[model samples]
Target: RLGELASLSYGLAMTVVAMKTVTPEPAESGALVARLETLSNAIERLPRVIPPRGKGEASAAPPPCDLQDQIAALTSQMEDVVAGGPIERREKAPEQAEKGEVKKKKGGFFVSGAFSDPAYSRFALKGTAAVMISYLTYTLLDWPGIHTAMLTCFIVSLTTVGETVQKLFLRIAGCLVGALLGIVSIVFILPDTTSITSLVVLVGLVTLPAAWIAVGKPTVSYIGFQIAFALYLCILQGAEPGFDLVVARDRVIGILFGDLVVYLIFTRIFPVSTLTQLRLDLDKLIRQCRDVVKTKAAFDPAAGAIQEAGRAYATLETASANLAAYGYETFHSGNRRLRAQANKLAIKALRGFVNALAVVAAFPPPQGDAEKSEALRQLLLHAEMNLQTLAFSLAAPFDVSSGALVDSMPPALSPDDEPSPQISALEALMARLNNVKMTLFHYRRLLHTEAGAYE
Candidate 1:
């Protein structure tokens, strides 16, 4: 299931990238165009269909004849609008192309580069070393019963040491819990169960809850699988139900040994810290938020920008979730508490900024009010520039100072004069932007302090 989810996410991300890379066709209007053409043709044939009105019979002008010219004119105008849309898009294409170029320039590394860094190689190497060590330990020792040690390595390995450690702890805890349950079943429940029906009922009773937990949130879901595993090992030990304490003990020991090996390897060897990755993820998310603002400012459809921002947000959230494993990380520099606090603040601020952008997107620009439209555009531009600076600062090395924080607010538009919905929406967006800047400023300060402590 997790693999399926990952595959879906990857496919969605690729789709978004493709959508951005390919120039979309102008808004679909084939149906409208066909309807207009049919109307125009019918109007052209109308005069031919009607018999000529005799002058001798009441000399009143036919209403259909009178309106034929007007109908034809309206149809022609509609057709022209529909036909000219592509021309308008073609005229604006160069300007859009220039904007796209500017976006690419300002995007920096987070936007243009692959998600994985050079540390990924180290990550792979560490995981391989762990699995190999586990395999050699069990195989050389001729301990076939403890082969689960090798299996554990594969299941617990993750991109960052912190995430690996987190999973390691989860695996161990779940194994212990499941083993205890299995032991209890072997001691008490197995003796009472005689028929296969009774054994089936007993297994179902245990598995029902385990499956429930497995289907729950990702963090705790592994526990359920482990519970079921341990119970099965103890309860079902062949064709028929047989109590096997020795096998259960060996499996549990193998799992624990594997986890220990992985933990040591990941921590001691070129450890990929989640804290560092969290900073990078935060930077990516900030830039994504900036992209959202840029799209809104350019009067472009924001669906793609919003989708990217959402993906970035999820990435950051996952990183933040792994922060708990910092306690298990060895040779870690910087104050973990401060780093976690900074991360939390960044998440909160970005979430607000994304929500505000959504609200801004909801309200269309004021119609026939060029001044108000321009004012909103300026406000969005201001927000975008500030976000860009923040993202850049975040992407910089932690030891390097980020200069002054972004305290300058976007110039406020006079809501009294315009008092339009667009102005109100922009105001809300500015408020959120201010909150984001302040949070980022605080987050950076926290990081500086952490860096100083490490130095």
Candidate 2:
């Protein structure tokens, strides 16, 4: 049920991001400090509910906080953690990454598409795959039956099981129900030229709404259309106006054959990690942190913005845990070394990005004397350029090992160089974004790694 929201609310959230409001103008420093103190004290007063320490550990009871209160606590904690004073911030050294290079920089449609989360790719694959299965099954059977191999495959892929099991379940449910509905359509509505055209139009109208309703809805609607199409084909062929059991059998056989293809391809050609996304998402977090750190050059980030970003990383960590589960599920024989390597680097990348971001932000350049990190001073321009590349989803040249790489990049995060109060409280937000990005890549790679599973 909730899965349906992936298409609906997910797109809506993206639309909201495209329409973000500009930061409000700042008042006096005294006013800002008062606000910062208020937020910090509020955060300090809130209840803390830490996660279970290890795998299989029972979760402790959640300490309830109102939305506002929770936001404050996370912000305050992120600042404290990143400040690395009383509590040392966790560190992930860089050399852990740098394994692979960009194989090729894509252009046009592929490049734009890559900037987005890849979960939707699976959905699109379902549709196209469904169409293929239907056409193939019918052709193999000499086109005797108006088969629904395509629609069945679409529905199956809509379900989670990665590919194969998802295909199996959805295909079964959709085809059976569709076939029954096709029978009803034949019983009630004629399939002459006019009627057929009307039926097609009706199918389109029905399916279009579900497309907006969400991804699965379209698949459901497609199944119904396939059912109509199948029975219509039989009727046009002048078959008797009753259920044809033989036709259904033909349909299933063809569908299974096609399903076999997808499954086999997945398990063979490339079996990838669904958790592969963490690397990219973590990469973004690092860039964002770098941006925050540079903010001090022009403007001191509202006292807690850096901390909030760190908190967001913690939330991302939680998502990473779930992603790790997928990692376990997707690993294959003979690929243990690659999987291990990927996971280790992934964790380091995740932590590194978050910590780096927070550190720069928390270490505010003194008022009226804004500079950059000593480790990165020479690389300021390069870092900014790299951040822009990451921000825009471009292929950036990564060579931070040079002795001249700077600690903080210049050019504040906000336009007109305004510091933000929310920056201090984004612990959950970072996690949420990182989680979404990570999950996306995880699905893509795992699907790739197990491409043969669809067969």
Candidate 3:
């Protein structure tokens, strides 16, 4: 049965290939195409003939026409069709014409624009330097785990200076806790564990919490991994009755040195400022919001606008969180509070903007309602114009207090309809717009205050 099925499948597949590749228009006779198609249909309908499987049973006779021979003939005809056929010549004619006109550039090994982009190139150079320096330093010191030290550099480094510093502190603290745990485990618990079974079980048991913490908060995740590393280094090194504490010590030192190296490279050399990042992200969010509001309501929010809004929101949030780390800075510390407040307000405004876009997308323009339509258009225009001004303010330092009080206010988007559930969403959208205006007002005031103090 299997042999019969295999033959049928082969015949069916080749039949399809022949039908697609062979054309009768260029053939000498159209009857040949029709006969081939009929032969394919007959082959599909032919029943599988299974031979009896008793001892010394004779096999069934094969089909009258050899299927392989038929397939080979069809393949040869297809080759002929492709070699000198009018269709093949027509297809290649255009390519031959363009080949003389267009000169293709020679291909060679090279870097493209994507690799040269400042986003990647800046970090690529810095990170490579950190890794190379860490490895070289550890090699000079004759450390046991020089690879771990180099890996630690990458683990702690972040895009911004404040973030890198914050992670460095966490890495050091986590490594110390982990190293202490390793010491306790080796000294008290596994002192005489010659049995591999007992050692495996105990190691697994201790690794549970580290694994748990590793999956938790991003701030402390590295600590969990470090703890496991420290424990492994202490318990797994050396081939005696017990591993030495010196192995764990070396690893801890290497980690500390790696973190120090990364901090010096990332923080002191063209360090990224959280405030500058926040400003840039906020400007991007403002532009996306403006475009979303100006766009006509459709079945859904514009995908580009929504995507940009999401990225902008995430970047701003990250920058805001990193900026909080600088609150511990001794220089211009008073401004940190004002910066935090502005960040909080800006985040709120951004959330409101996203929600407003959602609402705009949910309910399209009210057709046949001229008054409501005109009011909505005017409101959107006013909001867009104000947002443009705010975006400019974020990009460049400017006196915010000089703007007219009335111009700073949000445009009224009050629905004409009476109170009902049908228009509750519309009402809420207007409220969110009002909240965004209030948040922007406070944000501007905070910026002005910070600027004045610096002056």
Candidate 4:
């Protein structure tokens, strides 16, 4: 307590010292102080008239325009003139009431809305239905292994109906192929073999081809996964004896049951097309390309642009291939082949554009070529603007009857001849930009031609 009191006293002394140090001297403040005193004396000298008293009468307020009243009235008029209007009025009770009111909040089962997103809701309902139906089918049929069917239903479920159906077909085919391969390996190659070496060889033979396929295309990767799964089921039933053919048979049946259930549920409700997904992916790709061009021209870091480019390229490629495959599998009206052809050509052009941009972006503009560099920058900016325009048009539905797609596009830039070392980078960048412009023109031309053909 003594220490606390000493600390408090020290703080008080320091505050007093600080106040003295910062305060203006009396000599410096004398004029302001004198003015304030003179104003007070003048205010006191102003006349104040007392009201006449009457017997049993209360004194009323002075008239509004007396010498004191006139000054007060003039001051109020001056204030209103300066404010440009009457003084603002406020109500205390309304403010107090607003402050006092407490907001009512929802509670209890209202928390369920958190999980009620439409996209995820569809996923949940579809998955539940698929699993329930699969399990019920196996139970009714008295299948030996119902677990595989339940598991396959979960594994084969995808974001869209088209993708799920595609994967289901691939998975079923892979299962049949894998089961046959496993059976051959067990019976013909190494009959009644219990040696670890033989088993390793068998597994390696089946897995190598499957892995190769799995690494090839994103659309067909599920086939490799299912193949490996089936091979494992058939070849690795138990350590006892050699192989179990019944396991493969049961798993194949389970897979078929799951696929059927998933297909029925997915096709009947909330089915999203592979083509629609492709367009969205293409939109993303174009936007990423725009960012790359704009950021590169601004001399900002290009790391994010490169990463986005890679991802968009991969996604676009996968979606394009899937759309083509899906189109072939299903019945599509209005010249499906022509649409696919146009889409494929556009994808090809986009790939060229991405590759050229990547190459140019890899090299920065050489120093000591300010004029050339500025020219290059302007060209890049111009190309970026054209790209944005093209992206916008591509996003919209085109009509041949309205006009050709090429008619609305920006004119392509022509590349100049080769240059010396000093301006070589600029020349090279310009050439790539020209190529990009030409590809875009070609892409638009293809779209126009296809549209005209369809019409």
Which portions of model 4 miss their true places by more than 4 Å? 1-116, 194-196, 242-244, 299-340, 402-404, 407-455
lDDT (10s digit) by residue, model 4, range 1-455: 22322322333333223223333231244543464455445444533432333333332334332122322332333323232333223222221123569445557863446576677788888899889888887788888564588988898788765577777888888888887887776567656565888778878988999999889777678788788888787778787434557776787778777878887777777765555666566667766667667765775433333444455567667756665545433533465565556556656666666655554343333346566556656756766776676677667665435332232222233366344321343344345444544554554554456432112
For model 1, the run of ten residues with the poorest summed lDDT: 86-95
By TM-score, the better pick of 1 and 2 is: 1
Tens-digit per-residue lDDT, 296-338, candidate 3: 3321222233343344456555645644544322135567666
Error of 2 at 244 (Å): 6.1
Per-residue lDDT of model 1, residues 1-455, tens digit only: 22322333333333333322232443355764586567447544443233433334333322211112222333443333333211122121221234357332455545433456666667667878888898898889988778889899999988777678778888888899888988898888888888989988888999999999999987678888988987787677789766778888888899999999988887677766666766666666676666667776886533344454555557656655654554345325557666666666766776766665655543322346577668778888887777777676666665434444544656776657845544565666677767776777776676566552112
lDDT head-to-head 2 vs 3, winner: 3
Write the residue-wise lDDT of candidate 2 on 356-427 in tens digits.
444334433332223323323333344445445444432333232322221232334445544433232222
Descending-lDDT candidate ranking: 1, 4, 3, 2
Candidate 1 ranges with C-alpha deviation above 4 Å: 1-125, 302-341, 398-406, 451-455
Give the C-alpha miss distance for residue 331 in model 4, angstroms: 6.2
Candidate 2 at residue 190, lDDT? 39
Better of 1 and 3 by lDDT: 1
Candidate 3, run of 10 with poorest lDDT = 87-96
Q: Which is better, 1 or 4, measured by lDDT?
A: 1
Clashes of 4: 0
Error of 4 at 408 (Å): 9.9
- Whole-model lDDT per candidate: 0.64, 0.43, 0.57, 0.58
State how far residue 311 of model 3 sits from its true place (Å): 6.0
